[model samples]
Target: MTDVTTPGTPVSAAQLEREADITRRVLESFDGCADPRLRQVLQSLVRHLHAFVREVRLTEREWDTGIEFLTRTGHITDERRQEFILLSDVLGASMQTVAVNNEAYGDATEATVFGPFFVENSPEIAQGGDLSFGAAGQPCWVEGTVTDTAGKPVPGARIEVWEADEDGFYDTQYGDERVAARAHLFTDAEGRYRFWGLTPTPYPIPHDGPVGGLLEATGRSPMRASHLHFMVSAPALRTLVTHIFVSGDELLDSDSVFGVRESLVKDFHEQPPGTPAPDGRDLGDRSWSRVRFDIVLAPGGS
Candidate 1:
């Protein structure tokens, strides 16, 4: 028998066995890993990775290209930008992780991606206070209550909120020390909270880096639907990281990160100019928007 080969010839049985042996060897090498969980995860990862390589017959040049792509992804990441997370997001990995962590639990609010723009120690606002911080956008009144699955109020819950401005840029995108359009506030005794924030608006995920390139190459849009981000937590409730998207947003069906959930959409009622503000804050001749998002948290978590 001859080991003859052609440019597109099928892989020979002997060659397949050789590759399988390599995968087996790699798996066996982790037999002594002290952490059982780590070993299990790595072994499974190796199996899937090897299977993919074999199935695709990945070429050396292709592998080099992939390594270079990852290098570029890391180079562009910084304190303000997270290219890796963006990659996971566009590829649906982030959503998969979210789904696995957040299973159905009664009427608990569905969890979504914790986007890269969340800043720690955001300025705190009181109930009925303004979160806009003078950012540019139509004023919107946002009110909601924190409750458990049993419909009982969870008072004193810490709720963190943030969003992009009308122009689709978060405060961090400005490349300076400005914390506009984001804040944190605790719920009142009745587990009720309210604030004035910019009307949620559609925005593009940071698309000037490697993740953006991937989207362009794959013929996908980088624009996310308009949404307001929220992170709510209490003593004995699951910390919920989610978003409330605006109803009637065309991009809702095509959100770049696949973060839109049908249950998360809420109507942002339009308030015509001269409509009296709910909190007595003057809007002058400017039309505003308002929305209510009663959040139900699943019981049991730190």
Candidate 2:
């Protein structure tokens, strides 16, 4: 006896039958898809989309509005700004995809959202080198070791590090070809790596587009927690893209992209002014900080 009358507006049983028939026909049309995975995905997507339409009883005007919003999102996307990725991020789709792909195994570190700022063929640096590259921020000495989930060292792992400057902007945002606060380094034979980079400061995701409008309409913040980005890779090991958030950052609970994981937060111990550097490089009268992030990568097959 229960049907469309259960929620939304009361509708006749024949109306429900008509709507269901459309969904069924659409799903059946994909039965001839050449790819098995494509057919499965199409049918599943149709089922969920039809169910959503029915559940919400979406109005034509609302659908048109959504279409317009998506069109604007595409219009604002470019090589410098990936609005689609930003949209996926704000909707939690990126993190969900990351979660689905990066299965947990032992103490291996968790994965996180890969933001829109990554560039290919970053300049390589040696261990104990400065990654800051003259970017503006408090000096931070970052050191870590790369190991497999089995606790075995994975020497020569390539670790890519990048972060925003103190003014809450990446070097790319300066509208020039300069590369600062970003570099890659190889672990030593002992699987240890170190570099100098900025202590990450809180920043806003580029939110001036339709995605920003959506966030504003929903009463959500566009701020991300202070954190450092890392992309670690080695042969026979799964590549991991993640961030190490400052432990005491207030934005930890509310990163705009939902990229924060409890395991990824670490303490950045502050060193007083005139403190001796571990590598014997003079930090001068400037205060500095250090953090250790020992990474554990899962096997590639995982």
Candidate 3:
């Protein structure tokens, strides 16, 4: 047999092995996309995805299983639950996105994953009010200040807060009528805020779905460290989405969603029985814990 080949032509065997060519071709397909940003993102995604497939030499069966897993994840997602976000959280993608986009300025609060449980229009709460209605947990007092990078108070800052009960469940996880352990409040003129709630406790990410299956198959724990979630916003400062972790939590080093950072860990002081609360509420004999999570908002945006 006679071979017909050109000097600049790629040979069939070599062409098949040049995996990067596949990525290039996929990227080229989006060249006509009207949105430059979307085109750029898709191109990068294709490159990374192809690189990943090549790195692992992914087999047909593995690819099919991944597709099936994603399909199932979507099937299980709805208004109440978000399996895709849960998957991203478990894979560390959500936290990485936050880190890339929310670089702190001066002493502005660091950002973390927004988790899947935040609700719109949470009931407005007054300072010193309790958020632990119909929820079971150790009593806790949270006080904080919203400030600028220069330490000036940002009065009237809106703070949206949520967290699991001591038994590791959010208000959303219950079907009951009453809401618990979550509320939205505003800072006082001095930029100080306070509320009463349950002490945070470590809990598992929902482990009954596809993401959970992936965790079990990969030998990873689904446990998140004890923490309180906060989203703080002011007129001219960037909105901050973050969490304050329990300082001594066992899972701080192994949060299932990789959301823990050293700076976000805070001490939850155990108040002795019959002590006067910071808000001057008199409790007869009930022990309580207190955490002060002051926040500094980045300047600009919303």
Candidate 4:
């Protein structure tokens, strides 16, 4: 047999196809990867990506467009905003991912997506401190306990909370110097805690990216239902990332992110006038919403 070689020549059709085959074959290299979980995740990702390509009959131009769209999404992000998270929310990826990891096992608090706006290291305020920071909105009092699956109180749990104002705007949206509608509190010995904050209002997810374009093309609205965000953590329990939603939020049925779990919604009842708050603050002449709920957590794994 005679050997034929074409040095520095453009790859032929058979050669190009062979290269793709080699790439796929190389992905199978992970079959022997050290970490089982990582191997499974990568293998599944590759399979789905390849399947999606075939299903969509994707083209080179379309792939380039996708890359450009992602680049633009990254370019638009700033300190207080994240377009990638926005993209995930619109595509239902964020909700689906949370649902997979945060199953409500035996009445444990249901987890939800941690939206892009949460600021870490928020100022710690005493129980019943006003998270609303005197902002104008329907007032609300939230009280709850953190407990283990056995119903034993989990004291010293930290509850980090944030929510939108009456107009559905976060304090960060207004560029405010003071932290409004956000606070951190610790549970008492009995695992009980309470705080004051504005009742949440339905708000729109940022709609100025590729995701927004997809929504517009599909004739979908971008509003998220009214809800309160909470990041609760304790010394020996799985940290919870979840939300308490207003029961009657108009957009609940059509939440943009698909994050409204029926079990997570509760009524925000108006407190009667002149009722004294547990913290001894006079709830005089003001309308307020009240939520009394408890959280359950799984035991630490072995």
Each candidate: RMSD to true structure?
Answer: 2.5, 1.4, 4.7, 6.6
Candidate 3's C-alpha runs over 4 A off are 1-21
Per-residue error (Å), model 1, residue 281 = 0.7
Best by lDDT: 1
lDDT of each: 0.93, 0.92, 0.89, 0.82
Per-residue lDDT tens digits for candidate 4, residues 1-302, read 22123333344567556545855886888889999999988988887786566445568999999899899988978888788998888788999999887766777888888888899888788977888776668888899899998899989998999988888778777765667888899999999999888888888887867778878989999899999999888877888888888887788899998888887898888777777766777767876778887888776532
- Winner by lDDT between candidate 3 and candidate 2: 2
Q: What does candidate 3's lDDT look like per residue over 34-142, in tens digits?
A: 9999999998889888877765667899999989999999999988889999999999999999999998699898999999999988889898888887689888999
Residue 281 displacement (Å), model 2: 1.5
Candidate 3 structure lDDT: 0.89
Cα error of candidate 3 at position 29, Å: 1.7
lDDT leaderboard ranking: 1, 2, 3, 4
TM-score of 4: 0.86
- TM-scores for every candidate against the unseen true structure: 0.96, 0.97, 0.92, 0.86
Ranking by TM-score: 2, 1, 3, 4
* Candidate 4, lDDT over the whole model: 0.82
